[model samples]
Target: MANILLVDPDDNAFLALKGFLACGGHRSTSVSNARDAMVFLRENILVDLIFIELKLPDSTGLDFLRTLREDYFFQHVPVVFYASKTTHAEIHEAYGLGVQSFHRKPYLQESIEDEVAKLEGKAWYWSFFEPDDAFCRRTGRSLDERGAALDELEPVIQSAAQAYKNVNIELAEAEKEKILSEISGFRRKVREVAVPGLEEYLSYLASFAKESDWNEFKEFAALMGYYAFLCSYRADIYKLERKAKQASAVLDRLAQNALLRSLPPHEVHALIPHLRDYEIDEGATLFKQGDVGDAMYLIDEGRLGIYVAMEDDSEPKKIGEIGDGDIVGEMALIKNAPRSATIIALKDTRMMRMEKDAFTRATIQSPQMKLAVQALAAQRSMDSIKKRAGEIDISAWSKTASEGVRKMGERIPNGFLRKDEKESEDIKREAESMDHWNKMIDSQTFPVVSDAKLKRDIAALKGCPVVGSAVAAFTLATEGMVTSLHPLMDLAEHDPGLAFQMLQNANALRQAKTKDLESFIDDARLCVNFLGEKRLSVVTKGFPRCCESFMYLNEGANWASHIKFLLATANIARFTCAEMELLNIERAAFLGALLHDIGKLLFLRVQPAGCIPVYLHAQEHNISIRESEILHMGISSRQMAIQFVENKSIPTSCKNVIRWVEEPEKATEDFDLVSVVAIARYMCRLCKVGFSGETTQQDLLPLEHSQLWNSIKDRVLQRFNVGNFEILVRRRLRKF
Candidate 1:
């Protein structure tokens, strides 16, 4: 039976898992938290597996796992995380900490059993965790003794190391041949010299060479061969271990460098494994002018000179020098061109090489890195252009220009190109505003519903066969009423839910646009016609399915009331857009109005009883529905609606209007469209056209109070009469 440690604070969860594991023929040890688990582990009890609840009294499951992994004994032990509520980010962190498995607590018992069964057949080995220390440790002989005995091999080892380093650096034909010869001589010397720790064995073989005792000599020869093999193997292992440690040190330095400081830790971690270290001799040419570039190098030690060839076959001139922590050869790699200038080491140097493919992969995962690279490349290109411009014969070019042109140039003031204080202040203000908005977006956190749950709700709604027929009948009746081509029939035969939504949207538009409330007709054809064929098709295809889902999930009375509010808002938006004429997006405005509260529909579907508490909370607090929803769900209804519509094939304009309707000031591009929809929604809420699940009235801000509204008010007021529009809306609200 395998020994398992279970860490959980909840007594019920602990007992349930303990009992289940016992039934499965496993021995189990239980603890209430990470602290107790640590104490239990220190008792030297063997554990084959660990089951940890993400939440504990003392420390988090991830923290416990991280600390456990640091202990050599538990590094190979399998860890399974169990939690009732776990986010994707948390799950990612658990895996990053080397967790073997993750499962939701108190569920998926069978899957957990399967995972355990598979582990039983697997062989556990300590060698898999780390390399054998004996293979890397030196022989028992004193360092001085070994050094004297291997005096002939010391030069060979240094030459071999130098050859390996040169494999990464660019070299001339003569230098390449010299390094290759050194490597060949080193290999030959290693085979000829006596191996360390095998000197006595070799001496015994030499003495027995002339002896008549064949059996004794054979034994001596075998011992000599075995010791030689061990000495060679240990030497290779030690070299590899040293190299790995060096690379790791280089990675640590790179991670903290200014160029990579802005990258996320995970992205920087991904880049560490791909970096390779190289040591260059003093005055070595790293690369030459016009040579094809395949990798970029980071200077770890010493300095390098950048040189450019002069015109007419003159000698290459040193333009600049880069010291430690600077990167070079990146421009050629990024541009996919030959080296712009030759690079040569000024002193004995250590560098890290990152290949083109690895650099491309890294930048793809880190957009900030890509931007920084581009900005640097642009600055270098501009510097090169400026240097070339300075060399040009300006007097020759000026002689070709007209006298009047030269006179005009001479008359211009030197300080005329400088920016005025007002212009400079405007630029600074714009920059500050963008920076503030970026921080605001980054800091805001929204509650994310899983895709599986949302899909399941949609599927359940679609499976209700009655919704489709009801929607089709309502569509035909509404069309007939708007066209005046058929008699008005009783609404009982058709789907009341569909008919109610249609009537509300129609009347809402009429009240917002017309001077009289009586002029409003309860019809769907008008909305469809106003949307035009393309937009109408998009709305008709998706909106009906959504409405059916809402009807299937919610009570009829509540669904009807919610749809009425949306319809009234849509109608008001259409009227405002038509009257203002500033934005020619009447169809988009109407569509935005209808879908503004779509997020509420999703909330209702996910939790049918969730709205009751939200409304009650808003009523008690005397707040708006948006504010109440944010308090209850960690996001406003507008954010939820934006997430839902992102997956649909709707027009971007319509989506933007819906997204920014609640906060018109945030609409950077479609300000007019967003403002019109916002005004209409606010007016409808003020009029209380239908129940919006908000029991108490919310305070309304005047149009003049908003910066966005004030900016466009003069233009709108010049053509439209706001006083007359309010009178018309008040009269229309009396009927509702």
Candidate 2:
């Protein structure tokens, strides 16, 4: 109903107004003169509508409307003129002053009712308030021609839901990539068609309120909210996929840790997201003995000392220390018991902690992690059982050694690997490893080692611990009629246990091996020189390294591949060494080149179908493999190699090369060696001699002309300019 102010003084006019007002429930306030009407209009300037008679006793319609338009709310009010015997000029002037319409004297009540009903909704006032008439016409035209906006958005929204499903399924790598393309198409469709089409419709509907059909607009907008929800759904799907991929990468990295290796790959997959980051300052007790254990922690960095209670509680005797890659408190978490021992951070330690509840929930479905903990706890009972050489026969010790190791299940996060994927080691000899530390923690009698025990422990060890494929290395070793033992020896450098076995088999050591053995296998090449021909032959005859993928080169025929690419990298490294004229690093550089990509092999195993999330991210963003691995996994192949070999007996210079081969400036110890391997690999990648998962084609950074050239360029000889080096590399590549 309309709010009208009538200015006619005539009583007959009041009865005539009933034709529209009485039937339609329209409200009106009438005045006998312009004086009263003007007073009412001034007080209620924001009135919805106004009606006036030109034959009013005090004033004309023109004078009233002129004042309303000039001094009042300025043309914002709709006005109608109703008068008897009004002149044409007076009507023309009122119409020119923006009166909505003119009603003739004694007009039919029904005819007036039809005109008033036209103003039943705010569409009458909308014309005065919302002046975008052209846009309103356009919005209405689009609605009639294109049908509803939902017709366009509905199909796209449904396709987005389907695309999200395709994203989560375990598809082939190529198929997964195809899903990504479809997702990209969905996003483009929304941006280009769906969103643009809905823009005018939504905005056109938004400007309306108090209209009779307002409920219809509100309902339509509510339906369009699904399109809005589709927008959020698409966005959240991207975030979840990214997070899952990141968790998958974390799964792969966590699988490589030493303590968690007891858990199967699938269990680690389920557990990665639940792991909590925790830090303890140096000397702080991680957890006190007898405290209620709610969590277990895996050390990512630094060390912790195990303090067990003794008779009479003698200051919590410190028995042993565990460092990075080791886990603590599994026994407490598993048994649901109080912590048996106190753990204090020996240094500022960073660990991944998992609450019991979170652990249970994360691993409830994938129970391999739980089973590993149980198996180790059950097996740990054996740790307390002391079997001295004086107490047991030689054959018994051999048998115990054979029982501990799970040969084929070494590297982390290969959930797809089956139970039978392990080595063909004699079932009798390839048993579990008898950890001396576990026994020390159990029996508290730290004894000297035995030869049989040593062979047992080394036999249980993986070929390459952090990132090698002993299987691939073994494949390399037995590729031909001649049993090439080079991989085993090279593998021994990364794996000191492997080196110890090779050396032990040679029987050339001066002293008997001890249980407290620290690795000094810094140099891999020295293994052959140190062992004479007969001893070397003995080591060669026995190559039982079924662990990491040591990238050893035959250097004869296949040498062009396994080490040949590195030979090119080495030539560049040697040139860098000669430029500095520091000849010592040439050896380290050469060795580093051969060993640099063990991280790539490790990554390849982690996701044989390509870490699809990592792959798509790299493919889309144009990031290097190491960078992508670091983005999602928090570690790179370069860092993995560093972690694998940091404690090896290798020279510090070689470790430096490995540490900064891709990132030379980050090196703290030996910048020259870093630069050598850095520029060497950069040049080698440019040569395209072979494929390196670590270095992509996009990785041809600006290093050729970068300041790194100063480290390797010969200032005196002028032998290593970028232009000349390019020509040299291309020539070598062409000839080879």
Candidate 3:
């Protein structure tokens, strides 16, 4: 195994590289920046390989490479540039400086394998799946040892509990004082050590879900049980103190929301007394995964990080952050489930928590509040879940938990883990006994997702039969909350139905001389105000349910995936445009990207069923979907979309992008716009955000190797954070 040194400030890159090394039978130590890398190198003289990013906070990767070359000990050490920010000149300079390889961002398993195998002295031969593999077997034994240690700790915890009981029941003064001392020591142990350790385990297990084998999954479930046992015994540390002084401020903020504004002043005021102010210190965890949802906190001041341990357990991803006037932990209240994500205070924070009982009572008193609360809960759940929904291997976790865990449970003291046993047990048992594996997985995970407030909410959507695309549906379902003009305008250009409806409504209002007509029809942000949520709702809902052409109507996974792809492209387009701003492509790239795949739905709607799985073939053959479209039906999807919008009120720049997106150099008037779209599409493939038919690789070439990236990367690197943009594109993939 190679002793690798990782130099990258980005957590995304660091985790990715660490996982790569761990899986490939290599040892690695990581430092965030160049100085740390150098410092580590000096201390650890036996570093075998180095994976460095080009743009470091303190110094560039090229400078680090030069620094390495300057030293006799470090010179000739195999170095790979694991980054996206590279121009031809940078690459040429890197290789000229004796760099061994350049592995691009968003790497595939094969690429990872290839790079690992290329490590000069590393042992790369290992079976990843087999249970008997050296690493797996070794890790399994270590886990057994860890489990035994937990077993040893159980009796001590039991002794502490008994001591508390003994002191409380009645005891001599000396004995009582001794028991009290034991209780205090136990409190420190559980609060300072047990709680934090258990949390770290849970977070890591959550991220390790996909890679874990049956035994490891069982271990995770057992850990969950231990966590509950610890938390229950240490309840005194978690007891909340309510502050009545912040009631006025809490009431005022609560009144500002749309739901509160609709209620009568008395109804709104009645709910104020139930809110309890909570002060969370900087770095304090307000709540954790698997915690009971007794209350939901509405932020009053300071930032809170929403962390989901999705793909990597070493670091739970900070998916988003919320400040004053935002909600957290509501989904757990709505679904009546344990917390799915952990909320940690980034700074000293003040929040008003509304207990579930009071919230339920308030909603019961006001029917409008119930509907509004459910709607908000559904939106929030869907937003967080959408980012990490399909990725978690819950079925695997369930299957492992159900196997002889009955014996394990019988051994544990009855109250070991209080939650999840009754609710999730049947789902796990049912999953383990299913005949069909795929069906078992879907059903098992359904329970996990059902706790996302979707069981009730998705059922409710059956009543809302709207006629707009997913893009439009997302816009309105999210409360028609438009923060910027471009996201709105970009979304409008993609949904043909939305665009046409807006134009028709604009014309009707214009001819009638109504005040509703905005000066510009293309101003989507202003135009949306006139469109009305009710009207937009009708349009968007109808697209998936009303039309036969809308793909994956009843399939939530497929539906989410398809919509996610377009949104992913839009993200890439934003980056592409931002990068291309030097050459003066404004919002054209974003608008063009929205319309780039406009014909995909048309293909599904108009084409024969036999040939509609163009993406499947496109992926299989490693060819462009457009090429597959042309090969299958003698016409491209983009070409069909171009015809659809030719007579509509579509922007010329967008139309040109549709025309030249696949072949940007062919465009004359809209060269930069077309180029940006082309570049963005290329990125969408590279990042693998959503599964489209497009082959992300340009015929065995990476992004830096792609002709388009090489042509424009010089300018792109100056303005764009390629690593961050890749992160954003993948994040958007999970989001949509």
Candidate 4:
């Protein structure tokens, strides 16, 4: 039960407010005017809460609030002013005068109840005292006078009890009830209630109790009734005070817990009021895989195992482990990513859980700190991997061979420090390296791609480390073709061209003495410089062109037949070319295989912007090129010309290559060229082959024998290194 003081000018408003307070279990006092309120306070001043209306009969409510604030003792007590549609300026002014809150007039009954509850709920240390009223109330009654009134009221109970006993003997129960009801009705109507002068206060008192303990007063039983009401009222008010204190304590505890969870150890110690010790048992599972998780656990003691389910097995595999002084489940908590693994206690563990809300607040306050912690975790993971590595054998012959290479790299001049740095850098570097190697070995590392498409896209491109080596070798082996291009020779004649002439002179002098077949075999450098440029340019661009040709969707079958012809041309070019006799057949075959898609240059270039058109003719110069009679006639003319040249050493004419290009299907799968061609064509559609398309390799190569490795043995080997192929095939076949 709260002790409410309602200060309002309207009589009806005062009565309504007083009645409302009574229903809410408060003993309310009303004051209609500021002057009379000051007088009442001088007489009695124990107000738990004050609700002053903005309007008063005599003066402004704001002025009274200012007066209350000026008095040092009244500053602690909360004051809520009543208003009806107050403007922002008025509200700001009221708060400036030290009012705690405000209540709008004509509010719902529940709203009034909420304001009263707020007052009662507050801790009692800030309530008003006697000095507050004495400062302004001109009545000379001191603090002692108010204290005396309370003391005097305590003794009135015994005298009232004796009068009530006398009344019970004289009056029947029915008449007593009737008299009480009539008195309640009269008091309800006639009460002026506001803080009036002492004379006015006494006048109402006199009317209420005519003759104290008289024969009629005893019969009415008013004395016992009044004493009981005073006793119960004091008891109820005390209970409310106790409940308010308990609520305040709970709020403080919750605030402390929240602070501790959000802050770092040093800062947490400075902020939290107390630390609650917590623990967990061994084999305890904090969270399981696939669970929606929020809180993260901080390990204080004991070990934990982090396990993830294997891709091929139903049971979980132990991927990692952690121990004291570590934090777990944080990744999922921070990113809301799904839980990657399950954490189970390996030993009895003592840990603290920082809830999601606490984590969010902490992150908002210190983003840099979170990143530093992640960096530390990565370092720890690497360290653990190195530790585990020491216990594994990994000693197969192939493994031994790779390790030997690593060892040799270690022994290179100044190599000791490089190896040492790799070994000594924290575990994080090791974990990163492990993840990288695993992906690289599986081909899953580069990006998922079709074998044929990847080969075609990379064919004869010198930028890649592997392809660059092949290009350099080819350039060195084909230096004899430069003499035929008189235009390029004239362009290279002097001054800054001195370097070019010197190189050509050096190669010409070396070729003069290199006459033996074996001597010529070792002399590939001059040959490569002669014609290597044109061949490489064609091969480098083959992948993209092949991809375009294979990507035809509207008339794919016709395009497939066109691809078959290109493969035949590639095979003839590979085996029939004798000028490259010094190099082994295998090297020639690899070059042939890579060049199988060379026709795509002419094919896709003829397409508009090299785009795959709905009708291939949109990009093609002549839509009938695939079926023209000019193709067979041109090939016949070229063969006749080649037959008339007596020196077989003379290179095949451009017309011969073009004639072959015209009738693609007429060329057979003779030699390994056909297989190499099919593979290049396959890579064209499988964009992941890095050829830039949007479908699977299978869509591009639908032939029953689309897997064309056997048909083009020489050309295929030149593009893909044997060592890399072995590694990839072994990895893929592990399941089998």
Candidate 5:
């Protein structure tokens, strides 16, 4: 609240004296003696308070005080003088020289206070107070009016400048904040809009893959990769989608050529993530039984064989065969069923493989494909039957025939003679009353065979005793029967029992017959030859819708499809049973009619879809399981039985009825096979056997003609007996 100055040549003394003056109602300025006080007065011309020393120190304090009134700079300065030891006369002299107060030589405390009080009474003026005479007044005309106008305008200008400066600072800060916010918002949009858009595009790219669209796939992949790189600034959707699509594209292109088309789109996508390609050498086994089957194989190039064991022997059997336009080892994808067959490459091959889950997904989606795959499966089963049938021994057959001939044993029946003339007369009288019962076997329809009985018969032939000449005769007769059925009979080793069984099964399956059995057999032979052709037309024209279902095990599949197929197969087997051990074979045949091609598992290549040209037994064996698994997945164990066993290589539990019928001794144990065959045969008869009334037995015999059932008649009957065949037909008709 107060401004005070302390100046002194003797600084300590000035400070001391200033402290005493500060106690009054005024601030104080101190200066030593007179010279320093004069200089202080020159610079600071006005003071609210002041002190000076009196005596002869560099001009007396009184003269120094007097100098303040003379100079313009110090003319308005305030001052007081004091002497530590002063006479009354000296004080009187200082007061008379314009000092405000006077003190005696021994200044009493009360006197100093009275003097300081006297100075404070005049403290309002910072300029030196000069009694009333020093006050100035302007004399120009109208000066008061001009000064008043200047004062008013100065306040307006200062207010405007201050407001402008404040507004400028606020605007600058607001602009800076706005720019920062806009940048942040732009970045957010880029992530939300731009990044996700790229991902969606990438997803579409993965969907449209095809060999003809190779350029499109590559461009899309490049675009996706670029998107991923651009989105690398963050873990955005575009980057993830790009990577996923790239992997899927690889899977799609590399899959067994036609299989990807059959797979569900989503499953194809899933497999794209894990698909790997491999090149294989000729005659290489890709996998064996008991190996982990986490993935399915697709043959990209070259051929391979699927191999399985024969039921009665330890050697692996070639159940079926494959070439291009086939898929292999797909069962591992849906369930954990073990590999029942081994896939082997017969030539250097390329294969595309997918992980198991991806394969399962593919099957679960496409219904149309599921039905189409049955033909290939049935074809494979037929092939296996042919192959295994070749292994049957003819020696036992000769012995059995010879024994039947010998068993008649010289017990000839001749008309008995009467003991007397009276007996002769009685015989003459009896003859007039006698009536004959005529018994004739009428095969008005195609003759059906018992598969079960034939198997047993062949087994019986394996060890029975026979002369070499009889064996030769039996073998020749069987060959002749096959030759009469079809021309293609020459391409494959003919077994009468095998040929008969195929015809019976087909007849039972279709519930129809050829007007001429021989003509039908010839057609079957021609069809087989056509099937053996290795060309694209076989798949596109011959297989098309029929083979589509074979691709259920790709990565992106129709979801949850495999379960339905498995359930359907199981339902037929279970519901058709009249009793636990007795299934209506005709109804089962109808149920399995669609699945006759299940043996195609044997033909799958270790590569993608292709057939192996090599004759390695192991490769052929695996083809059986691969195809079986594809057609009827629920019978994995049965497929394994067929693959590993040497004889008629079907599982005892599933195919036992055939075993019992083939071998009468096993009848009690294998009643189910008997029952099923019986019912199937009955169903075939109901459909009406296929020969026309105009077709003679010779015309019906196997010929060069191409009728469906003509070629395999002999083989069919050998396996299935006439009795079981009739029973199967009757049983089915009863159901209807």
Candidate 6:
């Protein structure tokens, strides 16, 4: 067994490599950072090989190698730099520092074995000892005999290659038939697996086979056969993952949903694959009243408002609100009729929809499920009739008649009269308040500065050189320049203020615990890994001068709070976008969230006194900063942001995102992205990650159950393997 030292900052990666080495009869000692590796090397002198990651917590692997090479005892030790991706310059530099080999981090057992074999060949002590003849004979051969055997094998290898080519010529037609038959079998499996778009792919491959020449046909057949096998393998993996995910979702639904709870666990598990998951935005219609219901939906999250429209053309009366675990439209499926009420999402909602056919099958298979469905359907039918009867107009009755009816209604104690009266009074108060607030907003004047003036003011302020350099560095990293660390170090050297802010952010977002980073390079590496290239680039570009501007506008504590808020918002936005699968606009979302309050920064820079009055008004009224801005000044912080990026190269869609995040209802396009940013901002405030000078703790534009923790609870459970989001929040808040 070989004695090896493994140095990598990633705990998972280090453990995985260590396990692989153990399986190969090799012993490994691991340290997560350069400082620990140095201590280990000094204490233990019997290591035969060393494997290091390119990026370390305290120093680059290359730097460590240079230091190690200076030590006489370790100069000739075999060192391998195992990394994800390395540039030519980094490779050359590592070589110059006396690295014996550079290996790409392997993801397969065969690749791991190959790396171990290479390490065994380069053991420094092996050369010092002479081989024993008896041992050599037992192992198969001496050096001379091994060389002769290799010489003998070369012709045999060539002969085999020639024979392989001839076999294809001899059995071309038969081989084609065999491949076609196998492909035909695979097509049925593909369909059974239900891989989206695989049918069309197989059809295209079939066409290619028919149009090719003999030699090309053989090649195409081989390619098709391999692809089919690969798809089948992937399908198996996907099936396992899907089954695991659906099992949890199903168990949660069954535990809470009354109708589903009646069914057996095995029956629910069987039904899970047929259920379709959907995410609906607030104010979006699920189905209209009197529409044919093709599916029944179970609410897994958020609230759905059930409304009944009057025949007299009056506003629709909201019958009730149904929340998580409430099943809707089941009656429609059973009766084979229209839906009784319109269901609309009152907030962003998640649901699992089971079609009529699947529901029928489930009911048919489980008599208990059928009985439960019938009982619930009958109960809903009775409730629907009562709700419709209550909606009848009673204004035509005389006062005396109404009083007599009210006395009679009290005797029965239906409870509708008292509830309606309470609701009416609440609605009246809300309407009056809105009217007064609207008048105040209308009376205010929103000053619009010319673009030229805004540009001049922005130029006059000292920019954060570190942030600018990070942006430049991110750009270069994307273009395949030196590691992301190079640009970060350059930026740190240029401006320590920006570097300090970045380091703070890096420490906040780190998922692992290592020694505190001692330099900008180490911090940069951590940031790059945490935020990734795309998000880091977006963040740096969005707030080019945030640190400098914060210092210029606010005092010590306030400036620090503002910086924390920006970084927290940026990280939260990234997490939200990834969880939602919004890949196309992830960068845009990250940038929009980070710079959503840029206009406030600009106001602090150019019109510091103007914001004070607005701040005071917001505090007095218990409103958000945006509302106060609109109430005191006709425009909002969003308007300032619009002007700030008006002349810049930002996408119009991204600009719309920033404009409507505070008021998502007003957004004409990209509403989902805007809502995501809005939710992320709310989360940052809810967690009290930092102070953004917004007075109100509650969201200004509210939706029921729209808080970030509520909306993303299931997602966090699935993605982060955590039961509580507070744990994630506390982990992120460590730097604070």
Name the top TM-score candidate: 3
Tens digits of per-residue lDDT, candidate 6, 1-736, equal 5677778865445444544453454556678887787667655545677889998888889988987887533466778887778899999999888786787643333455576687655555333222334436655544444334333433432342243234455464556556455446545644433332444444544554445345544343333332333333333333444445445645565455645543334345556667888778999999999999899988888999999988996577898999997888888998889998899999999998999999989877644366556656767433432232132222211221223222222211121111111124334533553454455445753432333554566555433223221333334334333344444443332222333334445554442355433222223334445555555555555433321222222221243355567667757766766666677767656655665666665554444334556665665555577777765545665676665555433345556766777676667887767766776677666445566667534322122234444444443324543224434544555443
| lDDT over C-alpha atoms for residue 339 of model 5 | 80
Minimum summed lDDT over a 10-residue window in model 4 is located at 414-423
- List the RMSD of every prediction in angstroms: 28.1, 34.7, 29.4, 35.9, 53.2, 27.7
> Residue by residue across 106-152, what tens digits does model 5's lDDT show?
22324545655564545433221122122123323232332333233
* Candidate 2, 1-736: lDDT as tens digits: 4566667775435433532353344545567776776666544433456677777676777777887777412345677887646788888898888898898654444555566666765533233222224534654433222223334555665554344333322332335345345535544544433354334433443333223244443344333443444344334333444555455445444543533443323334446557878999999988899999899887778989999988787688989998876778878877878999999988999888989888667544433344445545776522212211122233322222222121112222122121222333422222322243234325634222333443343334333332222223322333333334444455444332333344343322422343333333334546544554455544444543322211221111121143345546766776656655668767666666656555544433332222334544454455565566565555654565556554444455655666676666667877766776777777666544443443233213334444555454553245445655555555555433
lDDT of 6 at 491: 36
Give me the runs in candidate 2 sitting further than 4 Å from their true place: 1-525, 532-564, 575-580, 604-613, 699-704, 707-722
TM-score against native, each model: 0.29, 0.30, 0.33, 0.21, 0.21, 0.28
Question: Against the correct fold, how does model 3 do in TM-score?
Answer: 0.33
Clashes of 2: 24
Query: Candidate 3 residues 347-441, lDDT tens each?
Result: 99988888999988887665435655665666743332222223223332223223322222222222221112111433443344333324523
The reply for model 4, stretches above 4 Å from the true place, is: 1-280, 294-305, 308-334, 349-736
Q: Which tens-of-lDDT digit does each residue in 668-718 have in candidate 4?
A: 433233332333333332211122211111112222223343334444435
Q: Summarize candidate 1's per-residue lDDT along 179-223 as a digit string, tens digits.
A: 445434544444333332333333443344334343454444433
Error of 4 at 342 (Å): 1.1
**Each candidate's lDDT (Cα)?**
0.54, 0.50, 0.53, 0.40, 0.36, 0.54
Ranking by lDDT: 6, 1, 3, 2, 4, 5
| Cand. 5 Cα-lDDT | 0.36
What's the candidate order when arranged by decreasing TM-score? 3, 2, 1, 6, 5, 4
